[model samples]
Structures are given as structure tokens and as C-alpha cells.
Target: MPCPDGNAGSAGASPRKEPITVTRITDAALEVVATEGYDALTIRRVAAVLDTGPSSLYAHIVNKDDIDDLLVGRLSAEIVLPEPDPAEWRGQLLDVFSQIRDQYLKYPGVSRAALAMVPTNLEALRVREGLFAIALAGGIEPRTAAWALDAISLYVSAYALEQSLVLQRREHPDQEWVVSREELMRRYTADSFPQTRRYAAELTSGTGPDRFAFTLALILDNLCPSA
Candidate 1:
């Protein structure tokens, strides 16, 4: 029988393409999370991107958690860890955290995946190692260093996710959305909240970068007073 295009039968058939690999699956999953939120990321969604079945993705990644781990691990790998300088450990710690937050911001909603996750992946371990080393070198006790690392990671991830949510809301505004800090403060002042009205200026004081730097300095000062 002739082919549909009138070419030779069988000979006109296209060659089979390479099967989807874990890396390709991961890329698709990240893309979905970037466009939608992390909640939209699923094996089925990723499979749809590859024109495959969920089972195909499952064969490589165990489940949604595995994909989340991969996404966070890939992001963690991009962080540029500063060399452990004892005198500059405080600044280095802030730099490390800033890099982490910047990486999470790049992918919009990916930071949500790192919320309660432990650092089991190699790249994540490297990030933790760098932070821990900096803490210890700056005279932090072992127990305090461990807790500080956890606290810093949690703060950075949560802050990045919060920023992503704010950006998302701004991009797709709703009736309930408050457009500006001025409007937010106006509403607060109009309400019956005495403390909020009194400190409205202090509450809405700084730009995003300024608030970030102020908070970072606060944490560093409290954690490593001598440093």
C-alpha cells in the first residue's frame, strides 16, 4: 500500500525519536511550576508536556516530592558560595542567602517546594555546608550554627515565595488586591487599629532592598555579635 503522501509504504515512516529522559522531565516540570505555581506541578502535567503518560515520568521520578527535590536541588547548585573568611563571615552569610533568594526568585514559585524539605540532595547539602562552615568559623557554637542554618534557609525560602505571590497578584489583580503600599497604609489608618495608624510611616518605611538589608543585618548582628 502507498503511504498517505503517496511515498513508499513503511519507507516513508518517520524514525522513532529518543525517549524522554529524567532531565527532560525535570525541565518540563520546572517550566510548569514557573508559569503556574508549584501547586500546579504534577506528574500528569509534566507528562502532558512531553506527550507521554504519567507512568513514564514515574519510572524516572518517584513522585511529585521527587520532582520538587530535583527542582530545588538544581536551583541550589546555582548558588555561588563564598570562600569561608572568618572576618567576613557575616557578610558572606548574607551574600549566600541573597544568592539563594535570587535563584528562587528566578523560577517564581519554586521556592515553595523548599519550605519543609530537608537538605538531602547533594547541591542542597553543599549550600548547607557552606553556611554551616561560615557560622562555625565566625565563632558560632555547633548547636547554634546548625539552628541558624535552618532558620536562615527557612527565612530565605519563605521570603522568596512571599515575593513571588506578591508579583503574581500584581500581574493578575483582583477586586480585593491592594495595589500599593500607600493604599495598604491608607486602609490601615482608616480602620480602627490604633498602633497601625500611629506607626504607618515606620511600617511602610523602606524599599524592598532596604528592608531585606535591614533584616539581614538584624539577624547577623543577633547571631554573631562579634562578627
Candidate 2:
């Protein structure tokens, strides 16, 4: 089957041959992860989607984490990194982080998949490589650059996971019903926590993009002394 445009299976396609086979299992994996989150992902569920036995899925993936890793790998492939420019290294970092946040939100359960993923695979390694190049261009030490990349990725993933949980709770009202008791908690905080109430607008302001921009600015400002 020909891979759809702008999707993973599109890689390595050519007019001369049939598009690489995209198993129903692969499509189902994405669906399961997106809809149910990583904890709920299972070989049996994927097999059910493909109308195959769990035994069959075992041939392709060792377990749920294997499939989850594949999902993150697919995500990495979709991200486009910029060529390092010394003059614009900071902007490039912001773009990369923004793209990561956008992609994770788009996929819903991606934050869970990212939790244990290391940059060992080709796609992930490429991102690390790109970050290293940018960091070098900006005069950062190699060790600092590597650790900083890991730190930034962890920060972004944590934020994405928090956002995903909120969205999931909202979408699944049954889950939200239990969580709905927390409205009083917010009120309580607003009353008892002076800072929370005083700057509630600042607290809620531009949560995604604005916060990202602010974070990037703060980091860049600190790094300016080094630059």
C-alpha cells in the first residue's frame, strides 16, 4: 500500500515500485496510543484492531513499549531541524522546541511515549546531532550542550504530559467527574495563595506559546553572558 502524503510510510517511496507495505497493525498502533494513552496500549488491543491474534503482534513488537518506541521514532522523523547558524542559534532552539511541543500535542499520547525514550535511534540521534551542531555554533562546550539538550527535552516532555492529561480528563468526562471536585481546590488556592490570586492572569496567560517564548527568552538572556 502506498503511504499517505506527509505520513511516515511516505519515506523511501518511488514511482517505479508499489509503496512499502504499511501493515494495518502499524496504523492501529498509532490509533491506540493516540486515543488510549501509552498505559492502555497493548499487543492484544492492537491485534484486535488488525483482526489478528496477539501472537501475531508479538512477531512484530516485543511489547507495548516497543510499539511506543516506534511511535516516538515516527514522531522524530516528522521533525525538521534547521542548519546551525551561529547568529541565530537561539531562534533555532526555540523553533525546535516549538515543533516538538506542537507534534506531541497533535498526537495526544505522545508525551507518555516520550517518557523513557532515549536518543539512541536514528531519528532521535539526528535531533541530538542537530542540537550539538547548533550549540557548537553558539560557542557552548560539548558537554554542556549535550546535557542541556537532554534537560530541555525533559522539560518540554514534562510540560506536554501535563497538558495531555488535562485534555484527556476533559475529553473523558467520566474521568473528569472525579477530577471535577477540584474546582473548589482552585478557588481555595486563589483565596489562600495570594500570589496565585494576585497574578492569576499572569499564571493563565498564553500557556503554550507565550510560555514557550518567555522560557526561551529567559534561557537566552542567561546564555547571553556566555555568548
Candidate 3:
């Protein structure tokens, strides 16, 4: 994308000298997302960000879905895969997934793209391979490890989508739909929600990351009971 400063060298920007590559396309696309939010991330918008036409992008990115794959691939580069340590596999997995979650949060609704991504992209594969190896180190069977990866990816994407929606709603100046913990606790006292009343504090307890980690632990711990 055209750097805000008009210098060729900047975050998610292309130099006049550099030929447009997939890297350039991905960078421009991210710039569009960062400035206008993910909903505004279209091939046409990315083209505008790069100071080019949509026609120029197609030679590099086949379609919208292809660009989505590239965007996930770009984000995957930021994931720091831990060296597979059998003893710390669960912790390692948590770190990787949390990194992905954070990256998705950065671009707001981009996690929705993540949900539709095929695993064939090489950058995405790198993460998948690293995660698979980690699960193997924890002594999970290959089939189980593979299936768990799908589940973990799905959950992370969904979680990030929810968070993005919350942020969007907050920007609207009408946050009444988001119940406060105290209000939720009080409401749970209704006779119809006896169990909720009894466990209100527990239900309203954890912050987002707390629940994120707790959920990851639930999946990872069972993968290797001894790990």
C-alpha cells in the first residue's frame, strides 16, 4: 500500500522499484485491513491502497479466497513455534495458538477469513506441521493430533471473531447488549436459572485470555494425560 508518509519504504508498502509480488499484495491487503477494518478488505480496496487497479492484483492473487489464504500465511509468519518438548507440549501449543489469536485480533474481522482458509498454503502448513510435531511429542496419536488441530484452529477463529464483534459493538456507543458481570450475576438469581444462580460467580469469573488459556489447557491436557 502507499505508505502514509509517501516513502516507498514502510510497513505494508511497496517501493517504486520493487515489482509487485505476493509479498507486496499481502502487505497492501493488510494495510487496507488496518486502515478500514477487515470488512473493507476487498481486492478493489487493496488495489486502491497500493495505488493500483484490481487488475494488477489478479496476476498475483487468483481470487478473494486466495488472498485470504495469503493473509493467513502472512500472519502465520509471526507465530513463534516452540521447539517440540514432550514435557512442555501443552504449554507450547498454548503459546502458538495464543500468538495466532493475537494476530487475528490485530486485524479485527480477519479471523473470519481464517475460518475459510484451506490448509494447503505453505505458510499455514508451517504452523500446522509445527503444531502436529508438538502434539506428537506429547504422545498423541497422529489421527487424534490432526483432528485436535482442526478443533483448536476452529475455536481460535471463533473466539477472535467474537472479540472483533465486541469491539465493533463498543464503537457503536450502544453497549447495553453486553451484560456486566454484576448484572449477569443478579439476573442468574431468577428461579428458572437455579444452577446459574448457584454458580454465578464461577460463570462470571475469568477474563478473555484467562478463559482462552483454560480452554486450551482442557484440550491439551487430555492429549497426553502424562504430559
Pairing residues by index, what is the TM-score of model 1? 0.89
User: What tens-digit string does per-residue lDDT give for candidate 2 at 33-85?
Assistant: 77777567788887777766788777666777777767777777878999899
Candidate 1 segments whose C-alpha is farther than 4 A from its true place: 1-10, 225-227
Could you give me the TM-score of model 2 versus the true structure?
Answer: 0.76
Tens digits of per-residue lDDT, candidate 1, 72-128, equal: 888888988888888999999989999988988888878888988875778988888
Task: Rank by lDDT, highest first.
Answer: 3, 1, 2
Candidate 1 — worst ten consecutive residues by lDDT sum? 170-179
- Largest TM-score belongs to which candidate? 1
Best by lDDT: 3
For every model in order, what is the number of clashing pairs? 0, 0, 0
Q: What are the per-model C-alpha RMSD values against the true structure? A: 3.4, 9.9, 7.8
TM-score of each prediction: 0.89, 0.76, 0.86
lDDT of 3 by residue, 1-227 (tens): 65466553476665465567888889988887777778998999888877778998888888899888988999998989889998888889998999999999999889888895676678889999999999889888888999998999999999999998888877777663776777888898878988888888898899999999999889877775333
As for candidate 1, its clashing pairs are none
In model 2, where do residues sit more than 4 Å from their true spots? 1-25, 177-191, 224-227
